[model samples]
Structure formats: C-alpha cells, structure tokens
Target: MVKHIWDSDRAAKLPKGVEELVYRSNLIGSDRTVCNWGGGNTSMKTTEKDFRGREIEVMWVKGSGSDLATMKTHNFTGLKLDDIRPLIKRDQMPDEEMVDYLSHCMIDSKHPRPSIETLLHAFLPYKHVDHTHPDAIISICCADNGKQIAEDIYGNRFVWVPYVRPGFTLSKMIAEGVANNPHAELVLMEKHGLVTWGETSETCYQKTISIIQEAEQYVNDRINQHEVFGGKRYQPLPEDKRKQILAGIMPVIRGAVSEEKKMILSYDDHDDVLEFVNSVQAPALSQIGAACPDHLVHTKRVPLYIDWNPETQDVHKLADLIKSGVETFTSEYQAYFTRNQQDGDQIFESAPRVILIPGIGMVNTGKSYAMSKVSGALYRRAIAVMKGATALGQFVSLHENESYHVEYWPLELYKLTLAPPEAEFSRKVALITGGAGGIG
Candidate 1:
C-alpha cells in the first residue's frame, strides 16, 4: 500500500494557495508508485491581481515539460479562469485550435505554456485538482475487466471515463461526467490515471493518497493470491555472470540501435526486472505496448525483446540476435508510422527506447545517462503495471494507433524542445584514467 506522507508541519511553512499546491504536487510526485516522472499534473484555482490591479480568478497549473517533484512557482503557468472556463461549453474543439486558444488565456504572457490538461483542471468545479497515473490505479485501469474491477473497488464513488486521448474533448467529457454525477468523489480515466479534487489542498492531497492506498491494497491482496507473470520460467544467472554478459553485449546492442543518433545504454537487473524478463509471459506482454499514455514519450510504444537463449547463446550469438531484433523492430515501427501518419505528422526516431533480454535483464537507451536511467525507471513501472494487471486478469495496453498519435503528438513533442542545448560532450562518455593526478 502507498503510505500517506503528508506532513502538516511542512505544509504549514508554505503559504496557502499556489505554494501549498506545489507542496502537495511534490509529495504526490515524490513517490514513483503514485506518478512516474513528468507523468502527472496538479492545479490550484486562486484569485490574483491582473495588470490593472483588479483581482481575477486565475488557474495555476503545472506547465508543459515540468515534473511535479521538482517544479516551483515559476514552473506553473497561470491563466485567467474566466477565459478558459468558457471553452468547456463548446461542443467540440480541434487540437490545433485549442492550443491557439489556450495561449491567449495565459494570465501573464511571460509565463510558460500551461499543461495540456489545463482545461481539465479549469473546467472542474474545485479549487485544488490532481491528475496522476498511479501504478495501483493503472493496474486496475489497464486490465481487460478494468471497469468491473474499479466498480468492485470503489463502487460509484469515482466516475469511470472510457479511453479518450487527452485534449479538449477529454477535458469536456470529464467536466460533463463530474457535472452529471454530483456524488462522485473522483474521476478515473480508462487506461490512463486518477483525478481527484477538493476545496482545500490538504483535503485534495489526502484524498489522492487514500484512494491510491485502497487500490494498492486491493491489487496487493489479489497479486499475492496468484502466481505473478505466470510464475518465472527462467532463473537468473549469477550476478558475476550477468554483469560479464552485459559488459560484452551492451556495445553491440548500442551500436545496432544508434545508427541514426548516438545513445547511452543503461542496464537493469533488479529482482522485479529479472523476474519479469525470465517469466513465461515476458515476450507476449512486452510487445503489447505501453501500459499508459505518459510512458509512450519516454519508453516508446513498445520495447524490443531479444529472444536469445542465455545458457546456449554466447555474446557473439547474442550480438547477432540483437541485430536481427532491431531490424525487425525498426521495420515494424516504420510500418506503424506509415499506417498512422497524418498530413503534417513527421516520424520520430525508429530506434526502440527499451530492450528486454530473457534470463538476463532490461537495457534502456537514451541520449544521456540521466535520460537512459529515466527510461529504465519508467519501464520498470510499466513492468509493475503489467504484473498487477495480468495478476488480476489479462493486461490490456493502449491501442497501436493511439500509441502512434501520442508518439507524434505535437504538444508532447514540444516538451523535448524546451530543454537547453546539449553541451559538447552531451552524449559522449568520458573516463578519467588517473584520478589522483589526471593531468600527470
């Protein structure tokens, strides 16, 4: 179960309103079980003075590209609530037009762009709102019988929203759902995440924590009752042997996938990772696609799984297998792009972000060490989600077309452009041969 870590004394030090919202956001985001890095958003509706010194209702939301755990006052974008609230009344709004419309709603032109789900926060009739992709909740959300499980867990306390890509339409649907169900205390987006709100920040934060704990307990209870991931099929090799194998194979796998852009590779052999990769269901489950939409941008639609026999195959054989697997993955990815491409849509890199080796571990690739680590962490969460969902029933991933759309979504892609330009040695690894006197 996810522990409730709210500290009243800590929260009391901060001002009430936006600062409290940031504190609440950080608390929720601090736990990977509650939300993955940059996977969730929070908002607070407060009255603020405009340029004319006249107070107007403003919605302060987590900005685009900002992570909840590390964000501050400047990381939030403030917008006039009166301006964006009216958007909820529209019958339909296109994605492009919605972006344009939201830019005009900013309370200060200098503030960063509001989150893509700003409208969802604005439309809800609450002062504090939180939308998080909690692993416990997502486990239930991604199951084939997700809706029925959710109902069993929470009954009608939370409103169940069918899968809808996050945008104007989804925002509107959530608002209508809340409006229609006055008794509902929370909103659960199918195959997505959980949404909670309150008149006070503490109330809001506590509600989010309590609900997740309930779901976590439910999943834990059920998971303990069954053989997870259909019980492990292969045993992990000794630690020394695993490391030796990784040292030999990392470069070959890295070189194979880095044809277009150089990449840094990070390896993981945690008990969970080893358990999943060595499981009977690893190949079928890993190929199904991402467990959540937020994971798409970081981990890609699906990870490439190398079908090599660890005991029978040498590093040379594994290298050849990596080449063959990557080729197949690239071809499949290109076909996916072709099938889902729109007029203005451009394809992202065809290389897979994650690779799983049976009886070995998982390898995550990115432009830098930090990014590679993040990819590994997120995929680990995906593994956890898959385990829980499958333990409950068959795990269901996001649709292929939906995965393509998210991978190419302009708004999602825009976050990548927000980072500062990489340094000269950005993607290059360096070694200091002589630590005591390197210059000598």
Candidate 2:
C-alpha cells in the first residue's frame, strides 16, 4: 500500500487551529488509490484562537465541490461547532433545512459555505474524519451477499450502516452507533462509502489504504476474471448518418440548459463508445439498475436506446425515431415513479440525461458539451464497474425506495444550485504512489 505525507512544514506555518486541515488534506491525497474524480471528503476539528485569545473549536471540513486529492488550505472552512452539535443532538433535520444551515452558519460569514456533509463530520466522535466512495469497497457492497463479504474482509474493525442520504439522518445514525461502540475506527456505509478516522490524519489515511487493498485482493481471488468484459466495438457512422443522429439529439440537449448559458454539444466518438454502441451488450444499457443512487440526478436512472437508423435522406424518419425513443423513456420513467411513489407527490423531469444509439456513440444531455461529457464519462465508469461486479456475482445497488429518497431529496438539489455556473476542474494534478487501491 502507498503511504502519503503532506507538507508538514507548510501545515505548521498555518494558524494553530489548522492541524486537522493539514491532516485531512494529506490523508485524502494519499488515499486516491481507491477514489478518483472528486468522490470523497475529509475533516478535522480544533479550537480556533481569536485575536483576544479566546478559543472556539470549529470543524474544518472539505468545502463543497472540492476534490480531496488536490485539496488545499483554503478549501477547508471553519464551521461553528456549536451550531452542528445541537442539530446532531436532535438527530433530525429536514434535508433542505440542513443545506440552509451550511449556507448560513459560516465562521468568516463571507467565505464559501462548508461541505453539505459538514454536519455529519462534526457529529462524529473523532477529531478527524475521512469519507470516500472507494471503487473496491463499493463494488463489493453493490454485490449480493455484500454483508458477508464485508465481514470477511474488514471483520469487526468496522461498523456497517445501511444506505441513508448523507445529512442529519446519516449523522444521527453514526452518532448512535458510536455511542454503542466507541472503539470503532471505521464505518462502512452500505452501498454508500467507507468512513475512517484517527487521532492524527496519517493513521486514518493509511488505514483507508489498507482496507481497500484487502478488499481488492479478496475480490480478485474470489471472482473469475473471464466474466468481466469491457464494452463492445461498433462500425463508424457515415457523415450523413452522424449528422442525422446529432440533429435528433441536439434539441433535447439545448432544452436542458438555461438560455443565458452558452451551450456547445459534443459526442464521445471514442473507440470505446463506438464499440459499445454496436456490441451485443448494447441492449443492457437500459437494464434495471443505476450506477449509484447519487448518480441518478445527473445521468438519470437509465439512458434512452436509439436503435432505428435514419433512412437514406429521410429527415422525418429520424425525427420520428427520436420522438419515439423519448416517449418510451418517458413512459418508463413514469412507470418507475408510479411504482416507487412514497407519497402522493408528482414526479420531476421525465427526460433522460444520456441517449444511447445503436451502432454509434452516445449523446449526453447537459447545459454545455463539457458538462455533458463529464456526466457521460461518469456514467460509463459506473457501467463498467457494475458490469465488472456482475461477473463476480449478482450486482445490486440501493433499492428504488432508497434511490428515490436521495433522488428527490432537497439537499442534493440545493447542493446543485449552490455550485458555480459551470463545472470547474482542479488546477492541481495529484498522483499518489503506493496508497490504497479502488475505493475512490
């Protein structure tokens, strides 16, 4: 496993209260072996010294939307420790209301809001908390008999919490569990993630690596490699054919973005995408599953399968096919919503974010082509992982009821609104050697 070390000298130069920040940043950076693509967060707590020498202990957690691998000093925010304590004590806070707390209770008052999970981090018993959706861990958790697998891999060192939306409720559960077993160092959130903490950041970070590596090895030994497969390849579409596909998809993509934002559309056109479009497994795109429950907001539950090719110079035919696919996807979504309705509330948008074309590449619906590409790229990754896990055994994610709770959860939507207009890529490039493997 890889061991990561942060800039100890640079961390020491920061204000006295930043010990947790230094620890968390390095721990996250080191544990990138499992999580990549900005999938996790970490936090630490200490008393902030005021100019008058009065001390106020605050939670310095990863800021919303920041990548853990390259997190910097400023990405950590000081949240009022007192405010979070009471909410956790109550063990309940409405989803949207929790987001409001994060937005309103700022230490500097003018700085960016803390992460949405800041409350969860603050409520934990440890001075430092690390959370990640490691690929290896998630892969195992998404399979049948995951509990047994986890027990065999992590043993009694970790505690498992069933899938819950990440917020006050999840924090409450963790708080209660910790109260029962105060010695627990790890919390394995079923179908969600792995949480590790320590007195110092390095201990928590190294433990994260060790756990994921163990899981990866266990999976390798148990699962047959031949059952795992990459996507299939397809023949290239001619110019007119490609243009027809774009014409059918562009309108849907345009309607999704706000009018004020400049929008551009692009396609994967990569070897993998092209191959998958024509492969025998193409029909599996719309199978009954999601990459992860959280991903439903961006990619939707499943993609629309476009199978009928536009006839030679038949514009109306292309339009008909597109409309048909849209209608089918909408019908399926309505069915899902009806079948999974918790209350009498109405459903959200019926449109799918990605459209899969047989014998061609896929189109991602987004405000801009870049954003769409990110969504599609993430979708492909999820599909690959799901397919890989199925090779070992039956693949599963959180149930639809659980998926719906998060899909309709107000905090998630609010978090989306709080994000900057366009997705921002990190300026720093992080590469960790010999850290953990496959959770992130």
Candidate 3:
C-alpha cells in the first residue's frame, strides 16, 4: 500500500487549515487502499471567535459525502467544542438524535450535515484526528482475534478498541480508553478501523499512514504466498451481449422490488466480478453482510446470489432464475423484517438491491440511477474486502442482528423519506381490451 503524505511543492494554494487538511486528506484518500472515497473522516479542533468576538473552541469535521481527496473548506462542518462535551458525557443517545445534536452545533446555518462520526472526532482530546478503514488494517481488524493481534503487534503504542457501533457511545468508550492510557498515539477499533490524533494535523495524518503500514507488514508476513487465492477469473457476458442480457432480466427485478414506482437496476460485468463469481470460495464467503458499517445504507445487508453458467445457460433460462432468486430474496427479507422489526416500523420493499449472478456479474437496484451506482461501487469493494478476509480465515461480519439494527436505524430510514415518493404508475396501466384485440 502506498502512503501519500503532504508535499510542499505539490500543495495547492488555499487557506491554511483547509489547504493543509485537504492536502493531507487527499494524500490518503487518493489512495483507495487507505480510504475509499468518503469512508474516512478527518478533523481539526481550533479556537475561532464567535460573532460576539469571544474566541470559542470549535471542531471542523468532514461533512456527509465529502470525499476527503477532493474536499474544500466548505465541505467541513464547524461546531462549538463546548456543545460537543455535553454530548460526550451523556450515557446514551439515539443515533438519529445524535445527528440532530451535531446539526444544532453547526456554526454556520447553511452547512450540510456533519459526518455521523462528528462527535467521535470532537470528543477526543486532540488537536487533529484522522480515521480510516484501510483495507489492510481492516483485514486484520476483522479477524476473530483481531484485538489480540493488534495488542501483540503494537502493545502500549496503540490502544485496541473492540468493535462498537460508531456513535456517541463509541466516542465515550474511546475517550475512556485514552484517559486510562494517556500516552497512546493510536487507537484501533476492531472490525472498524484506525483512529490517530495528535497536536498537529501532519502528525495525525503521518501516524495514520505509519500504523497502517505496520498492519500491512503484519498481514504480508503471515499470509505470504499462502496460495490461498484460487479461482478462474471469468468475464461477464460478452460486451456485445451485455445490453441484451440486462434488458432481458432487469425488468423482472425492478417489477418485483418496486411498489409504486420503478426501481433502477445496475449491472456489473467487469473482469473482477468474473473473478469473484468464479472463485472456489464464492459459495461460502459471498453470503457475508455489507462491506462496512456505512455501506449498510447503500448496499443493505447481504446480496441475493443467483447461480448461473454462461457456457451452458440460455438467456431465457437465466432470466427465469434471476426472477426466482429475487422472489426468494424478497421473501427472506420479509421474514427478516417480521422477526426483527419494532412495533412502530413497517416492512420495506422486497427488492434485493445487491445481486450476485455467478455467470454475469454483480447487480444493484435503488430508487435512482445515482444511488444504484453508489451501491454498485460499495458492493465491488465488498467483494475485495470479502476476498481478503476469506483468504485469511472464514469471512464473518457484523452479525445478522447487527445488520438488522443498522438497516432499520431510524436515521437511515429517514433518508429514504426525504426523497419524493415514487410517481403513481397506477394511472398509466390500462385494460386496453376494447381498442385493440378486444374483449371489452
């Protein structure tokens, strides 16, 4: 894994905080291995005078969907430090309410929502903070004995934090750990990622790169040339046949998942998809849950798997299989919802947003084309993460119970409600019998 640190010669001209942070952010963000798109968050805590001219400590944290690699000053949300302290001390706060608390603290009324991890960055007693779900680090973090491995490797150099859903409680847990071991420079959140902070932004960024490098070394030394990788990398439907294949099958999936409006479908036919589908362990490992915590919203839990062989299966036969797979997926989703839903919540659409067809490629559906693409990207990353995890050991992720909690989290559901309701398709359907071949 390559680590890109700030380079004075290459730095772009901008305000100090924004320039330095953005420079540092892109250095890592540019490398998907360290932080893929918006998967990580960064911050700097500094004192800025309020409108009354009295200086107040405030945190500038990465905002929602802000790609660190391409971030600007406006991409961060600035919140008063004092406002965050009260939140940290609270024993509990619902995730959605926590979002409200963060929004309430934003110094600028127009700032987009801060990251869900805003509190986490604010509560830590450090001038600068950086968190990333580096694939190498995550490979180790997700191990069954991940914490033990972390401890054996870093000892007192880093504080090993067990997996906790990222929220106010997680921030509190991290704060307590830091207090107990004041000298620690890094904290590893098992099955999540790494958090490093320092008195300077450069320090935090550098430390993050260094620690992840160490993790890379550890994994390389252990899994070196294990011949653990074995699979025939298959190509998706020939490029020429791709359009025909999708046209034949996507309608069935869209109709199955759509309640009142159309659901957009995304198909993947990249070489990597073929490799994962044809892999020896495809059956055992692809069933795991979303690649990362935030991915739960974009990709949902596990994807529906449709077993097919392009060499032998005809297009018509494959369409029927895809339809059957979606039906089973929706039914399973219904059962899952029935078993886990709280009294007030209702069941969601039966559509399997993420689909894996062995002979084709990965598929995803969303309310819109953009969202479908986002899910597609996340699923591709999921494939990479899963491949890495299985090579090391059996792949396991947040339990089905955890997936349920996140999938149904009020905040995530709230996002869906923000989109305009699907247009009424009922108005478009017609009997059409009398005008045409007619049996009115």
For each candidate, the alpha-carbon lDDT, in order, equals 0.89, 0.66, 0.75
Please give the TM-score that candidate 2 achieves against the real structure: 0.74
Q: Which regions of candidate 2 fall more than 4 Å away from where they truly are? A: 1-39, 50-52, 69-74, 86-88, 96-105, 178-183, 221-224, 229-264, 269-282, 307-323, 334-349, 358-361, 420-440
User: Clash pairs of candidate 1?
Assistant: none
Better of 1 and 3 by lDDT: 1
Q: Write the per-residue lDDT of candidate 1 for residues 342-366, one digit (tens) a residue.
A: 9988777788899999878999998
Tell me the TM-score of each prediction against the true structure. 0.97, 0.74, 0.85
Candidate 3's displacement at residue 305, Å, is 0.8
> What number of backbone clashes does candidate 1 have, counting pairs of residues 3 or more apart or in separate chains?
0
Evaluate model 2: give its lDDT: 0.66
* Cα lDDT tens digits for candidate 2, 1-440: 33445556765566655655655565565454455444667887777765577787777887766666676777778887876787765746886687777765567765556776777688786877878776667767677777777778777667778877787788888767766775576777777777778777656666777777787777766545643333344456775777676776567544443233434445666665665566655566446556565577777766777765433435456556767777777778888888887664558667667777755577776655555775687667565556546655676776667777667765556556665665463221247766776753
Give the higher-lDDT candidate: 1 or 2: 1
Using TM-score, give the best candidate's number.
1
Among residues 3 or more apart in sequence or in different chains, the pairs in candidate 3 whose N, CA or C atoms overlap within 3 Å are: none
